[model samples]
Target: MIGSRVKYRHLHTFVEVARLKSVVKAADSLNISQPAVTKTIRELEELLGVALFERDGRGIRITRPGDVFLRHAAASLTALRQGVDSVSQELLDNVPPVRIGALPTVSTRIMPRAMTLFLEERTASRIKIVTGENAVLLEQLRVGELDLVVGRLAAPEKMAGFSFEHLYSEQVLFTVRAGHPLLGGGSVFAGLAAYPVLMPTRGSIIRPVVEQFLIANGVAALPTQVETVSDAFGRAFVRQSDAIWIISSGVVAGDIAAGMLASLPIDTSETKGPVGLTLRTDAPPSLPLSILIQTIRQAAGEVLPV
Candidate 1:
């Protein structure tokens, strides 16, 4: 029978090597000898009974098993760091920050108002918001890296082990710079292929929605296009060039109102979905986190027709 053998050193070394993609570089980054790093990885692989990394020509690539373990391993490290900080005198003396995961579409519209209100009420509290694709945010939430996530609800399979609170319904919209050539179109969808198209990134929450809308409109493919999830990039790119940006309504609501952009006359009700907050079912939020959630709800009420 194997005795207790796994340790923090093993996981730490393995993650660094996987991240840096080189044993030597990981050793340098971890301030250890290459031999020690290699030995640690070997030990971890033995304990797990699976090869985590395999040589890919000169470099190394993580095996399917290693890729699977990487997510949990990194999450464990993040949890450990937060756990240590939670009890530290320095952290205990001060309020812990509310770590949040935000979607790009929500960040531009709802986050600023919610965060402003949250900070105003909890003057001593700090906030750290990490924004990314829906899958990434949901994974982070499930693994305890984030206190809560605010955005559109993801697909059910990816939404395992979390509770979503529906706040409002938001639609997807097509927009371009005011008075663009696509404006006087017979059918904007027909004209879309001629202009440069900006689409939601492949992994983002709205990517499938945008793609489905386009496909249904006979825009199955385009010659010139960019796929991104950056609201700032989309805003700038669409305004500067004859680019048609398909994005959530809230992201460009302010711009459309100010005449910096105009929404194409298209009925896209099918792309509408519920925007809301998501929290881990097993993990209860801290007091500051709860307060922040409340403030966010209040802000949403004011800004949206909730």
Candidate 2:
């Protein structure tokens, strides 16, 4: 009977070559000799009893069998890594906690619930949560300080090395205090003009949608009295004054439930924003981060409106 003889390093080398589709390039990337890369590939193919590549005069291509083999090999590697990471992560005496950046709105509402669930599931795992605007969050993501960012991304045209996954759409609500004059009902825009507006600072994804809708309908601009990124401030301002605040329904769901704020009878039918998760492209995420994101998607699916 043949004994178990698979080597972990060989599997890793095979994955790198398969991913790059060129032995020389893979070797250079791994800082090894090309022949060493070729030798490992051959040894791996022999162990599996399958031809993994087809070489022609032009170049080499992964064979149909090779493509199938790669799928299994990648899965195996991913499983092995996840297992190893779970163990080694605990022993990482000096490695900082997995740092995650989240938008303030998300951090305030969904993330607290998600984090509580994550901690319950992973007692040994450590995480650092940072809150910021998208511009700051994306920069931290690119510099490797952050593993994942939860928010609506800014400027897809300029974001070449990042990928975004839509978690859910947040409904935009224009809200005010319960007894505010506009409380019962009125023309949405004209009513807005009577009250000072609490607006998200410019360039926020929320701002453009609100501004454009008001302008397109020829709704006169309300007095822009407060501009801030703090949802707490916005909600507090609404409770104390006649200022109208445009915000995500999910963020203020609890407040609305408590009767702290009242949703205006305005047509928000045209306003929807994607609350998304952003990750670095062409890279595999850390296992803890990956599981956390998966949990977020599941949680978002359950809570976010369709």
Candidate 3:
């Protein structure tokens, strides 16, 4: 059992070191000496009655207990920060801000419209938007750092502690520049392997489906591949090169509608996935959060392609 003697500083230091995998880097990030960082970790380990990390050569590996503790420690720190922010807002602005996490797909297509409509109605409201992969966003939502997350459904294991509300369904598509050579090719997949490809990052929920689709199509490996989830990079790269981009249909909906990009004619129904809202089961929504959720539903109805 962990003792109450552990300090927040200890947990903070431990999390930093675990994240960086180097005590010196953690020390520099925290603006403290390396020895002080080590002493804090030691104290926390003693209090918990478990070794948190193991030093091997020049790097450190978090022990099993450390991995478990890191989750709780990070959650605690996030909760504390939220509490401070809430109190500060209540004291000064008399209104608490709503924090939201959105995956790139929704951020690019739906959020801009939703945010505009929401702000138009509630002009004084404050909303903070964070963009990241599903796992990172869900973790933040779980820990109360975010009021909710809007994105594709995560794998079953990652959805363990949260509740999801289905918003809509989305499919992955293979897209290219408007006038790419593949446009009139008799064998699209055959010629695809000759050009560079852009794939979703590993953390994306649709990445595995994208890989499976490629395998099913008999393209064993792309000649060249770039993995990313940045909409700006994707837009620029595809417009400037012959690289094929496999991504959520919603992300490039505007580009497709505007004829800036073209979706391949290949059927991709097998890659369909649910996009939704993820929330902590234990927490009730604040007024601002509740309002935003309604606005999102409305905006999705308006913006998401049929």
Candidate 4:
């Protein structure tokens, strides 16, 4: 009722000029002209029947009434600004996170770098990463629980409803802590058969590959001492003891590079296979997922061939 003629233009111009202490700056910030800012403030004072500012040498001074009005006016604008931001943030939060399943290898090696790039590519978007055996991840993909899967291709029968896009080729490798009993002076096969061994969890894509490699090398019976897809457990267990860890190269590439682990000299070319992206054949990737897929590819490129 008191400000029936007052407008957003009047309040905004006055508040900005007062805050900046310069009409020239307020006009520049608002992308208007100096005279326009002065004119608008004058209009606001006329409508309110009060002098909002007094000329103070080259600058300006706020009147007591202007000070009171400014406190309320600035607060109102701040509330409006926050309301706009909250609405935008709510919309972003409402968007379902892009759910993904990653094989242990990809989760450890590829995802860390890919996540950094993905965040850069789409700062407002979000994602969820699930890591486990190949069979488990594929099952999650078949359901609606996952939008994508990254790592080696699944078994032929398991490929019925999923499509795979080849990313790179990697192979199983034998590794142990930097200083282990098996590091010198023994036949590799004998050491593998004799020492406690860690292997890929059963039903993982790499599990079969590793089994075949062992069989070819005269390690006919798989080690039952430990079978897991957990990088943390494998690294910890192997480091504190003399257990040999047979895992995909990507999973321990960093460890080997850092000298925390060592790869044995063995031939696993027969176990080499394609690693790739898997998705439901029936479901097209959402735009955000597609961008993330690209980011993963960029990250994957950094993985050195084993």
Scored by lDDT, the top model is 3
Candidate 2 backbone collisions, by pair = none
The TM-score obtained by model 1 is 0.68
* lDDT per residue as tens, model 1, 51-138: 9999999999999999999998899899999988777757646766778998876787788988888878745667899888878888
Please list the residue runs of candidate 4 whose C-alpha ends up more than 4 Å from where it truly belongs after superposition: 1-7, 20-22, 42-68, 179-182, 222-224
Report the C-alpha lDDT of model 3 over 1-306, residue by residue, as the tens digit. 364687889988998999999999999999999999999999998898899999888788999999999999999999989999898777758666789999888998888988988887764678999998888888888888898999988889888878999889999999999999989867888988889999998977788999899899898988799999888899999999999999898888889999999998889999998999999889999877888898899998887643
Off by over 4 Å in 1: 1-89, 92-95
Worst 10 residues of 3 by lDDT: 88-97
lDDT of 4 by residue, 63-92 (tens): 999999999889888898899999999999
| lDDT pick, better of 1 and 2 | 1
TM-scores for every predicted model = 0.68, 0.66, 0.68, 0.83
lDDT of 3 at 130: 93
Candidate 2 ranges beyond 4 A from true positions: 1-93
Candidates by lDDT, descending order? 3, 1, 4, 2
Per-model lDDT: 0.88, 0.79, 0.89, 0.86
**Residue 17, candidate 1: alpha-carbon lDDT:** 97
Give residue 216's error in model 1 in angstroms.
1.7
Candidate 2 lDDT over residue span 1-306, tens digit each: 111676877778888887887888889988999999889888878887888888866667888888897798789989988999987866875655778898877886778778766877764667899986677788889988898889875576747799988887776788888888887666667767777887777756677877887788787566665777788788888899888887767667888899988888877877777788888896678777777887777667776654
C-alpha RMSD of each candidate structure in angstroms: 20.2, 17.3, 21.0, 3.1
Per-candidate clash tally:
0, 0, 0, 0
